[model samples]
Target: MEIINFGKGYPANVLLPHTLMQKACESHLQEEKKLFLHYGHKQGEEKFRELLASFLQQNYKTAIEKEDLLITCGASQGLDLICQHFTKPGDTIFIEEPSYFLVFKIFTDRGLNLVPINTGKNGLDLAELESKLKAHNPVFFYTIPTFQNPGGTTLQEEQRQKLVALSEKHDFLIVADEVYHLLDYSMRSPFPFCHYSKRVLSLGSFSKILAPGLRLGWIHCCSTLLNKMLEDSVLGSGGGFNRFISGQVYSFIKLGFQQQHLKLLIGSYRLRSGALYYFLTTILPDVICSPPEGGYFLWVELPKGINAQQLLERAKKHGVTFHPGYKFSTQKKLNNFIRLSFSFYDCDILEEGIRRLAKCF
Candidate 1:
């Protein structure tokens, strides 16, 4: 039997827009061959940045200046760039407890101190965050506010405003990883964090909505921050990262292909999410999980005395797989939790995976 895997947060291979991307590439070569083929600005091609700024402003209802955006390889690179420019080896960086597992390496590789704040159904605990902020004087607070990875929680607007206030009071930067914000299925998300605070550095990626191979993402911040980041030797040496790919993506957006693609992705994931949710809730009534309003994951908390790592080993025998929650925690305290992704499989495969998972429990 084929392994029904739910371990990685990735778009289904079938969902990738191969034809659309090909068309965009062809269009870029035909329309702007010279501009795309030649070395572009280290900050990004001016036209593409303008297009991106307009796209975000239109979609999120926030005014964005082209000068305030920096095109990075992807959100991962954006995070790395931020750490490189803004942090020292031993600086304190706060993050949500049970945060994105991969990013933990990014922080640790930089030799930065990782402080995790407890998260709940409503998102990060403000009291805990404020207390940590007051005591630590952290370099920055990193968050995946909307449809958070491994937690499936969206921070409320009120909490967002309050968090911004806290950032201002404590004078710490807010690094908002918002790649999942645009993938919402039903509930509307709040404006990007940059809108509420000038100190906020918002990171976005096309990996979820489009294809990950494109390797295109942007950093939204004040012009001051953008200028400082652009001064980094990496951008100066490379003359901007992913300029040609950025040009292709700009063509894709200019022709309105991204919006159409987003609708298809949202609709497909919504169905997959519902099917998995129903199966888990009905078959394993004792399992605690919330249906995510958007994004790719469902965070499940198993009953006490269950260790997710051991559970994964058993589930593997049944041809099912999922992400054990311990990987997502800085303190490694959530052994009873697991993260499930609905974006990697169709509804039929997802339901079967959950059915197999239920048996393991």
Candidate 2:
């Protein structure tokens, strides 16, 4: 039997716009091939940054200056760069109890200590956050605040401001992974955390909105913090990271294809996520899960007395797979939970996966 993969969060192959990207690359080559081939400014290509700032400002509904943005190969590289510049080995950093599972590896590779902050249905546990802050000073609180991976929950605006204020008072930076900001079905993405304070660094990637192979992303921080990144030896020696990819992305956004393609992604994902959620609620009424509003995942809590790992073992026999929630937890405690991704398959396959998962119960 062909296994239905509900655990993978990658966009479906049909969803990738190869033709659109080809057009962008061809346009860039026709206009200015030699400039992109040569070394770029350490910060990035100047006109590219300007275009991106305008694109973000229009979408974010807040002012974003080119000076505040630094281009990167991708969000993962951006995080590594920030950790290298701002954190030392053995320094403490806070993360959500259940976060983007892969993020732990980046911090662990850098030798930073990880602390888990409880995340709830609403968002981060603020009281728990303050209590921990009293005991240990963290170099940064790295969080995926909007449409958090594996959780699909967003931090409210009030809490966002409070968190920034705490960061200001404690003199710690807020590293926000906001790569999913643009895929909002609601169309009104929360104003980014960087808007609240200079101490906040927000990461955005074209991987989620466009194609992942481009490996193009940007970091938004105040000019002061941006300079620290600009001075990093990697960029100083290598010039801009992914200069050629940045040029192609610049053309993509300039041609208005980015906006149009983004709309297509949002509409398709909305239907896919809704179908998965509907099938689950209708077929398996006992399971508990939140309705997905945006992003790639729907976090489900199995009925009491059912362990997700055991369910997965049986689910494999039925040719369906999902990520057991323990993988996302810092403390290894959410054994009864599972994370399902609606972005990788269409509604029919999603419905079938739910049915196969039901048989495991």
Candidate 3:
């Protein structure tokens, strides 16, 4: 079978630069080998923290400092630690109806009720959010403002401001899942939540843009909340990260090889996204699809009365696969929609896969 798997959000075909590895190895060898091999600070490497803080301050123009950041195993861990520290059984949390699945699982397993609001083209429906907030009074509002998962839509500038206003008025923290913040295809950069850092808790990861094997992620928030979350992380998982991977990542960053690699990665994804969109527009004319401003996935709505799950079975028969949209919804109402990732396939493969699905529909 000629398989075209667009089911996951991993870089489809990129290799770790041998130069980066050699540099890291050289650095590790220069140091006391035992220190490099041993455990690191639970908060993460200070040098890495400095690098992140400088970048965040420059990009987001926030008041964030080194003390405000907490490194984690991945952004997933940051989300988990937040839930662990702030929420309890029966607590109510708010989320956009079509959000990332793991987020829904986290809240559900913690016994927290989720209030999901419908999102509009520009992003979360602000008017609906105000209405829901007034009625349900949730503990926190979760959002993926930049290249949001499943929908692959971005929150407009006005909506970003409105969300911050809503958080303040409702007296709730805004949990911003921003692991894909840097993946915008547009010339202009998307707005990050750090502008409202005091009220907005942001999470980011190297897993999406960089390599996931590094297992490095970080959380940004006010010192009070961050300290609390850090204490919990220490108790639960202990502070130091995967020591070897940390050293590897540190060396890569120090050598400045990842920067050039990132540009290449983005350029490749941009081409892939354009190719995927072209295929859908030409091949799957009947499918309702949104052109993502930036991100890996294309969110498509099948014709009314057609079941996305059923289509997935047919697609699998054609040796193509993508995630069913219902998985992203807590209420499981988006059964007509599906998410197809373009980052994992070349232009030819993407076109072929779309052609296969087009035949089935």
Per residue, candidate 3 scores C-alpha lDDT tens digits across 79-166 of: 8888888888899999997988877888888899999888645568888889887778787889988888888888877777888888
Candidate 1 positional error at 94, Å: 0.7
| C-alpha positional error of residue 104 in candidate 3 after TM-score superposition, expressed in Å | 1.6
Pick the lDDT winner: 2
In order, the Cα lDDT scores of the candidates are 0.89, 0.90, 0.78
Q: Which ten residues in a row have the lowest lDDT in candidate 1?
A: 31-40
Residue 181's lDDT in candidate 1:
87
lDDT of 2 at 182: 82
Candidates sorted by lDDT, descending order? Answer: 2, 1, 3
- TM-scores, each model vs. reference: 0.98, 0.98, 0.92
RMSD per candidate (Å) reads 1.1, 1.0, 2.2
lDDT of 2 by residue, 1-361 (tens): 7999898889889899999989988898898747478888888888999999999898888999998999999999999999999999999999998988888999999999999998978789988999999988999999998888988998888899999889988888999999998888866557888877789899999989998888899999998888888889988889999897888888899999998898899999999988999999999999999988899999998999999999999999999999998999877888888999999998999999999999999
**Which digits, one per residue and each the tens of the lDDT, describe model 1 over residues 1-361?**
9998898689999999999989988888899847577667988889999998888887778798898888989999999999999998999999999899999999999999999999977678999998876679898999999989989898889999999898888888999999998888875888888888899999999899898988889999998888889898977777888888888899999998988898899898888888889988998898999977899999999987889999999999999988898899999889899999999998888888888988887
